[model samples]
Target: MIRLPASIRAACVLAVVSALAACANRAPTQFYTLLAPAEATPVPAESGYAIELLPVVVPEQVDVPQLVLRSGSGALQPVDTRRWAAPLGEELRTALSARLSARLGVRDVYRLASPASLPLYRVRVRVGRFDSVPADYALLDAGWSVERRDDRSVRTCDARYREDVGAGIDALVAGHQQALARLADDIAATLRRFDAGGCPDTRT
Candidate 1:
């Protein structure tokens, strides 16, 4: 083996140490998904109206793959270790779809696609704000609309929901799920009213 200069050998050792330090300092990423509670309610047969759930629109501040936490001073911080299993918007959309489908007792609910020939009621949700303070609370402010395909009639609604965060990240996530479940319940009620030919109520 050839003898190396002292400076070069020191540089090589330093590089190896830095690489090891980086690997040791890096945090492992954790993934999470939202889930709805199981219900004992039975599914309704052929509600005669097909429902289409459009992709959810979330605020730019929190529409990320990582979990967002709001600071006491109102700054938003993304946690690198804790992350959403999917994009945050997609997760919310899927959770809402499942909740609405179950609550409405209809199998005709869909996301992104619907039968063209069938009369469809399209539901669109825009989330103005979704954020949580760790161990404090999770808040959601959202506006939604339902439009009738045949009559071209539209009904818009808005809701604000908050759930207390009890302990850790699991509690924060559970709070968000509860808030979303409440939102879905409101939407399902509106759909039922619309199906009954009643005018939409915009009040939350």
Candidate 2:
């Protein structure tokens, strides 16, 4: 077997090393960025109808079924674009409390267990869909509904609101918050009706 000269072999080795160094130094193409938590602008009270929220009823399939979206095939993933916020239930509860308190002028808007709460109404939310599509750039979808315990009436048209969120958790949070804002408006409307005696008595 014929062997290459020492100088040529050294030159070839240097070329291979230089190529590897270039490859290593190249800019990364798999760009992945996580979004920061969104700041909530507190809603000011509007109607003076105080209400306390009950523990939200989340679907049974997820660990925090109240926050993440699960697929039909049982894939549990976050739909909220904001990964830094509280779980879906808690976040929704806090957001709703802020908005409702601002609109209704509730003395204390809190979870069900808060003491000294006055004439507090109960709000229940049901999530219908929440998940992400990993293919073709991650896409998030979240659906939800809210209701009052006193009347057994459903809002969200059967917990059905959908938002196509971006890949960032903050984007997801925005989407979820938007849906909740819509839901809170519906609930607030109903609460106003209740206050105005517009709701019919079902006792009959």
Candidate 3:
């Protein structure tokens, strides 16, 4: 039997202990995505155009993979154990794409070559502020615009949505999802009135 020397064996034992300690101390990360809620029947777009949803502009503080939650005292907390399934910006864009396409019954034409004959509405969203507070609410404030590709017509508007949440990570994520859904609702309505000056009334 070829056995290790005493010093080498001791060092090997120490290394094993360190690795096990790291594994024990490190918590498993949980990923979450913004999902569309069950809505009413799908309605075809009034303009019969596909959507070119640009990548969302998320706030710098919450743009990372971790969830940046707001504390009761207004301090920001980035929880590493609770992370987004994708980059925060992509997650927001994906959620909007799903909800908006479903609502308008159009396909997402992002980064795809669409024939010039097809009408396309380019939608852009920039998040001014985002806050997630457990047991309180998730707030999303964003300025979004929709531009008609052919006529260069545009509708620019900003909306702030808040959804109350229970105390937990899942509830917090669900709140944000609902908030984004509301934003989608307004945007969808505005798309129907592409050339209108005022934004849709989301009150109720």
Candidate 4:
């Protein structure tokens, strides 16, 4: 039988202990995604006008795949245990597309990719702020623009929404979902007005 030297045996035992410790200390990561609102009414057929939704842009502070939370002192912290199911920007675009499609009753809502033909309206969204503070609130501040492809006319809008966060991470996510749903409602209303041939005067 061959025997290892004392130092070699000690090193092997230390390596095994280190490996076990690493496995024990590793935390399971939880992933979350934004959900679209339930459709109360059925969506209608295509309106002969399609909408091109651009990729959503988020602030650098919260652009990571991990869930970012704002502390009371305004410091941003990434929660290692909780993370986004996908890139945060892509998730926001997907959620917005679903919400807008249902709200506008249109079937031709495009995101990231567009049809060969030009769309009637091109929508772009930029999220300046998106974060949650534990037991406080979740916030979403965004600026958006809707442009008429034919006339090249554009309408810009900004919205800031906050939802109260309750006890757990689930509540925080729910708050973000609610905030996004409300923001979609506002944009949907604006799109309806544009379709009706009534665009509001540009703000000063």
Which candidate leads the pack in lDDT?
A: 3
The candidate 1 region of ten consecutive residues with least summed lDDT is 12-21
Task: Enumerate residue pairs that collide in model 4.
Answer: none
Candidate 3 per-residue lDDT over residues 108-133, each given as its tens digit: 88999866777988999999989986
Clashing pairs in 3: none
lDDT of 2 by residue, 59-146 (tens): 4543342234333344454322213334545555666666666556564455335334234455655554444322111222223243
Residues 60-92 of candidate 1: C-alpha lDDT, one tens digit per residue = 999888888775556666766778989988899
Q: What is the C-alpha lDDT profile of model 4 across 1-204, one tens digit per residue? A: 244454553444344334434654585777999875476788766555668788999999888988776654466667666788989998988888888887776554463454547457888999999977655678999888888888898778887888876645677889999899888777777787875654443221
Ranking by lDDT: 3, 1, 4, 2
What does the lDDT read for residue 175 in candidate 1?
Answer: 91
Q: TM-score: which candidate is best?
A: 3
Ordered by TM-score, highest first, the candidates read 3, 1, 4, 2
Q: How accurate is candidate 2 locally (lDDT)?
A: 0.45
Q: Which stretches of candidate 4 lie over 4 Å from their true place?
A: 1-26, 37-40, 108-119, 195-204
C-alpha lDDT values of all predictions: 0.76, 0.45, 0.79, 0.74
Every model: Cα RMSD to truth: 13.3, 15.7, 13.4, 13.7
Worst 10 residues of 3 by lDDT: 12-21
Q: Which stretches of candidate 2 lie over 4 Å from their true place?
A: 1-48, 65-74, 77-84, 109-119, 132-157, 195-204
